[model samples]
Target: MIVLKAEVFNDGRHTGENIAAKLETMLSSWGIPKENVLCIVRDGGTKMKKGISLLIIKNIDCLSHQIQEKFENEEDPLLWWKVNSNKYGILSPVAKEYLVTPPTSVLSERVFSGAKIFYIPHRNRLHGERASKLLFLKFNIPSLQFNY
Candidate 1:
């Protein structure tokens, strides 16, 4: 998880088209080829859904909060994926990409998300970086204004 970009949303219009345009500009600046986007996890806002659809990538409901609950009561998901990656074959890589996804984006957006699941044993060896920092990066999303 890393903070790649940050900017103010001076224009308070959170329309889907406007959001998509802003997203495209950011993606362009980051040199992220549009086609590489496997999926997007978004909140239950109409504009959010529309904007994600505009990107033409798979969109998933924001399930990070639920992930915390699951972790508290069950097994680690990343570890599960690592163990089952071979069994799933092609889907394994897809799971990896989605596992790192953030829930949403705002002014201080996180380019890469899903770091909240980093509480596993391996997190302590993350080059001396703090777990809180990783969680912050995971929650960072590109800036946009919308009703939630």
Candidate 2:
């Protein structure tokens, strides 16, 4: 397994030298050479411990993850077409006028917050299901189909 050590001190709270010492101790015990490990130092005038300066090591990147990342980086017209589609639950006329965007985050926040509130008995028996459908309709505001 390839080990990566990075200096994660933003406000001089930590140091790269301190990190290397810890890595050296850990790697030494595992019978791994010091050259095998990699250390990334933070930029700017920050004081680290002592000897931990710069250690560079090469590691193989996962092919699957790399391909997935590449795909994510590339722009696909089909995706944009779907994103602009009314069925994708993004763009809406009523939503555009009033609501800025879909309330996904608000709903998530509400889920946690709502759990604390009193168990208010719903008015309708199928209110939960109806509400979900209404939410879908609200976000995916229907566009007139041009049946040519």
Candidate 3:
């Protein structure tokens, strides 16, 4: 398993197209077989062309972007924004911008959330998927106090 640290950007110039190309180049340079590589891009709306190119090059894709997309596209847009805002917070306008148009870096949030799931505990109970969802709804909905 080769872990090449890279900063993925959703910027037009640094889109999945360029990222995938870079992965291929990096793997080849390191003498790693393309088939042995796994490319975990943090882009959810990546067009099929870019995804197919990565797959054809034999890198396994991470589902973080897909999961984020699924949550964001839920029936209730308010709930979605609330969840994201609670997660991203208002400390940085850049983070707020990401909540609206998620940049590639948002994948880090997802990864750390997964880690938090394993770490945080409530009343000596490990929060399972159902409880976690409920907690997310509870915390995210009631905590939203808009200044407007």
Candidate 4:
């Protein structure tokens, strides 16, 4: 659920190559080595798939993605993966990690929703830097106060 980037883009078209380049730049800026990025979890959109593929990282399907097709048992995929982790030998840990993939982009959506609360019509004149700082504090203050 970590949010590495929350930028507003005005690009007319978002192509796979452009997305991949941006992702690479973002990862490098964060000091996250390419090898450390094990997998990317995204929807089945062609653009998303192509972008992730260009990154040279494994791309996995969003477990809880909604589609017209339905499975017989509607069990939680993470739970199922955990229960069967033992069955996978050398890849067991990878399996568990994959299971941790967020079923949806709800966390990012929530952050956007929270940001909207701060940027009300009356307060829309706030400077971009001020707004960013306020949003950062609003989201991270709780973690900062932890005893650990």
Per-prediction TM-score, please? 0.41, 0.24, 0.31, 0.44
The lDDT, on a scale of 0 to 1, for candidate 1 is 0.63
TM-score, structure 3 vs. true: 0.31
| Model 4, span 32-97: residue lDDT tens | 987777554556777767777898866556545633333357787666656655553335577677
- Residue-level lDDT tens digits of model 1 in 15-113: 988877777787789998877764444456788678768987555555552233234337777788787766555566888887774655642243234
Please, what are the lDDT tens digits per residue for candidate 3 over residues 80-129? 55666545343234544555644577755765665564465554565568
For candidate 3, the per-residue lDDT at 32 reads: 79
In terms of lDDT, which candidate is strongest? 4
Stretches off by above 4 angstroms in model 1 are 66-148
Per-prediction RMSD in angstroms? 15.2, 17.9, 17.2, 15.0
Give the Cα error of residue 90 in candidate 2, in Å: 38
Better of 1 and 3 by lDDT: 1
For residues 1-148, write the lDDT of model 2, one tens digit per residue: 3554333444554465655565566666788786754433333323332334433333223333332322354666455444554542333343344534455698756655544332346634545666666555544554534343
Scored against the true structure, residue 26 in model 1 reaches a CA lDDT of 76
- Clashes by residue pair, model 3: none
- Cα distance off (Å), candidate 4, residue 26: 0.5
